[model samples]
Each structure stands twice: as C-alpha cells, then as structure tokens.
Target: MLCAYTKLGMMVDARHLFDSMGERNSMSWTTMVAGYANIGDMKAAKEFYDLMNENNAVAWVSMIAGYGKCGEVGTARRVFDEVVVPDASSWAAMESCYAQKDMRQKLLSYIQANEENVDGTDATVWGFFIRCL
Candidate 1:
C-alpha cells in the first residue's frame, strides 16, 4: 500500500500510512527513500535513508542516483565513496552519472582508480565505459 501510494505520487497518503505502521522493515524504509528521491525530494529521502537501521546497497545506490538526478555529482560521488563494498550496480550508477554529465575525464580517472577493486565478473561496468567512451 505504501509503495502503491508512493508510486502514484501520493506521498502525503504514503507518509500518513508509513507513520501509522507499528513495525517498519527495510523494504518499508527503502520504499520511502526511493519514493522521495523519485519526486526530487532529496532532503526527505536523505532523512529517511539516514534513519534506516542498516544501510543496504539499494539505499546507497538510490542516494547516489538521486543526487545524480539532481545534478549534484559531487554529492553523488560522496555517497558512492561511502559504500563499504560497492557492487556492479553501484559502480554503474556512478559511472552513468559522470557519463551523462559529460565528465569524461572524471569518469576515466574514477575507473582507473577503482579498477583494482573491480573483480572480473563485473564486466558490465567496464562494458558500460566502453560504450560511453
């Protein structure tokens, strides 16, 4: 219901329902974060994200992607850097941000600096750069 409300852009209703819930799980929290971020409400998204008991890759990537959508590339990078162990999706999100913003040099520099950490199976991230460049 909360996700449905948020998906429909009924944040007010979503919030009302969310507030009334007795026990919230990660899905609930992530829903709100993704909801607010979808609406360009970073402050609210961050508030919800920060309130989460444990941060997950979904939440982290959402923040990075949210900030990226808002043209806050620096903030996105900061969020990406905060990830303890970023997965391919996380790397793709950051790379897409830099690519979309036409920051090719930064993208190259980032790839070079992070290459050592990327395992062989995460070829999608490298493939993304190949297409982007």
Candidate 2:
C-alpha cells in the first residue's frame, strides 16, 4: 500500500501508511525513505534514514540518491563514506550521482578505488565510467 502510493507520487498518503505500520521492518523503512526521496524531500528522507535502527543497502542508496538529486553531492559522498559494505546498487547510485554532477575526475578515482578493493565493478558502475569518460 505504502509502496503503491509512493510509486504513484502520493507522498502524503504513503507517509500516513508508513506511520500506521505498527511493526515497520527494513523494507517498510526503505519504502519511506524512497518515498521521501521520490517526492524531492531529501531532508525528510535523511531524517527518517537517521532514525532507522537498521539501515539496509536500499535505504542508504535512496538517501544518497536523494541528496544527489537535491544537489548535495558532498552530503552524499559523506554517506557513501560511512557505508560499511556497499553493494553494487549503492556504488551504482553513488556513481550516477557523481556523473550527474559531471564530476568525472572524482568518478574515475572512485571507480579505480573500488576496483582495487572489490573483485569487479558492476555494469552500471562501468556505464558511469564509460559515460563520464
């Protein structure tokens, strides 16, 4: 229900449903974060993200993408830095964020660093590098 409202851009209704959920799991929390992000409410998304007891990859990616969409690349970078184990989706989101800002040098550095640390880069990450280059 909440996800449906969120996807439909009915943020207020989605938020109400989110608030009504008695036992909000990680998916519920992530949906709220994504909802706020989808509505261009990065601050609200970040606030909800901070309040969560457990932050999953989807939540983190959504928050980071929200920050980027709001033109707060530094804040997104800080959030990325704090991620303990960033999955391909998280890295792809961050890469897209940087690419959107035309920060090619930073994107290259990030890809290089991730390649050195991780086994391989995801297709989206490679796409970011290719598009930026």
Candidate 3:
C-alpha cells in the first residue's frame, strides 16, 4: 500500500500508511526511502536509511540513487564506498552518479576495479560504462 502510494507520488499518504504499520520490514523502509528520493528529499531518505538496522542491496542502492538524484555525488560515492559487496544495481548507481558528475575517468576506474573483484564481468556493468563513455 505504501509502495503503491509512493509510485503514485502520494508521499504524504505513503508516510501515513507507513507510520500506521506496526510491523515494518526492509521493503517498507526501502519504499519510504524511495518515496523520499522520488520527491527529491535526500535528507529524509538518508535519515530513514540510517534508522534501518538491516540494510539490503535495495536500501543501499536507494540511498545512492537518492544522493545522485539530488546532485550530491560525494554522498553517493561515500555510500558506494560503504557497500560491503556491491551488486550490479549498486555499481550501476555509482557509475551513473559519476557519469552525471562528468567524472568519466573515475567511473572507468570503478568499472575496472569491480571487474577485477568479480570472477566474471557483468554485462550490465559494461553497458553502464559504455553508456557513460
């Protein structure tokens, strides 16, 4: 329901429903964070992200994307650095952030590093890098 509201751009209603839920899961938190991001509220998203005890890939990606959406490349990079094991989405978000900031060299370095860390290269990562280039 909250996700539905968020998708509909009714962030206030989503927050109301979110607050009413007695049991909250990671998805719920992610939804709210996504909502904040959609509405260009990076501070609220970051705050909500901090409150979460267990952060999944989605949560991390949301924070990174939120920061990127707000033109805070430094914050996005910091979040990217904090990721333990960045999945494709996380890496893509970081790449996109760098691209948006016109830091092509840095984005290329990240792609190379990520490729070295993983046994096999991800096509999505390559695609993201190519798009940036």
Candidate 4:
C-alpha cells in the first residue's frame, strides 16, 4: 500500500502509512527511501538511508541515483566511491548519472577505468556506452 502510494507520487499518504507502522523491515524502510527519492527529496532519502540498519546494494543505489537525479553528481560519485562492495547495478547507476548529466568526458573516463571491473554483459552499462557514442 505504501509502495503503491509512493509509486503514484502520493508521498503524503505514504508518509502517513510509514509513520503508523510500528515495525519496519528492510523492504518497508527501503520503500520509504525510494519514496523520498522519487519525490525529489534526497535529504529525506539520505536520512532514511543512513538510518537503515543494514545497507544493501538497493539502498545504496537509491541514494546514488537520487543524488544524480537531483543534479548532485559529485555527491553521487562520493556515494559511489563510499560503497563497501559495489555491484554492477551501482556502477551502472553512476554511469547513468554521468550520462544524464552529459558529462561525456567523465563518463568515458569512468567506463575506461571500469572496463576490466564491470560486467560487459550488463545491458545498462552497454546502454551508457551506446549513449556516449
């Protein structure tokens, strides 16, 4: 229900539901994080993300993408760099961020740096490469 409200951009309703919940699992917490991010409230998203008891890749990517969406590419990069164990999705999120910002040089540099580390088969990164060219 909360996710439904969030997906529909009804943050007020979602927040109400979130506040009413006595206990929250990671999914519930992550939903709020994503909700805040989707609503362009990166500060709120970060606050919830930092409050997460166990930060997973999805949560980290949420912040990365949210910061990027808000045009805070440098902060997004910092989040990318601070990730303890970044998976392919994390790298792809950063790449997408750079691409969306049209920072071609930075995107190229990042691609080159991660050429060996990234999953070549990942479609998102491949899409980034295609967009860069």
List the candidate numbers ranked by lDDT, top first.
Answer: 1, 4, 3, 2
Q: Where does candidate 3 stray beyond 4 Å?
A: 113-120, 128-133
Candidate 1 local lDDT, residue 63: 88
Which candidate, 1 or 2, would have the higher lDDT against the true structure? 1
Clashes of each: 0, 0, 0, 0
Model 1 per-residue lDDT tens digits across residues 20-47 = 9999999999999988887879999999
Per-residue lDDT, model 2, residue 117, is 56
Clashing pairs in 1: none
On residues 47-113, what C-alpha lDDT tens digit does candidate 2 reach at each position?
8898999888888888889888887888898888778877778777787788789887897887687
Candidate 3 lDDT by residue in tens digits, 8-89: 8898899899999999988999898888877878888888888987878887888888788788988898898888887789
lDDT of 1: 0.86
After superposition on all CA atoms, what RMSD does each candidate show versus the true structure? Answer: 1.4, 2.0, 1.9, 2.2
**Candidate 4 regions off by >4 Å?**
114-133
Measured with C-alpha atoms, the lDDT of residue 124 in candidate 4 is: 73
Q: Which tens-of-lDDT digit does each residue in 1-133 have in candidate 4?
A: 9889989989889889998999899998998888888778998898889898987788888888988899999999988987886677887788778878889678777777968766788787777777777
Model 2 clash pairs are none
Please tell me which predicted candidate would have the highest lDDT against the true structure: 1
Error of 4 at 3 (Å): 0.7
Higher lDDT: candidate 2 or 4?
A: 4
Compute the lDDT of residue 118 as modeled in candidate 2: 52
User: Local distance difference test, per candidate?
Assistant: 0.86, 0.82, 0.82, 0.84
Model 2: residues with Cα > 4 Å off, grouped in runs: 113-116, 121-128
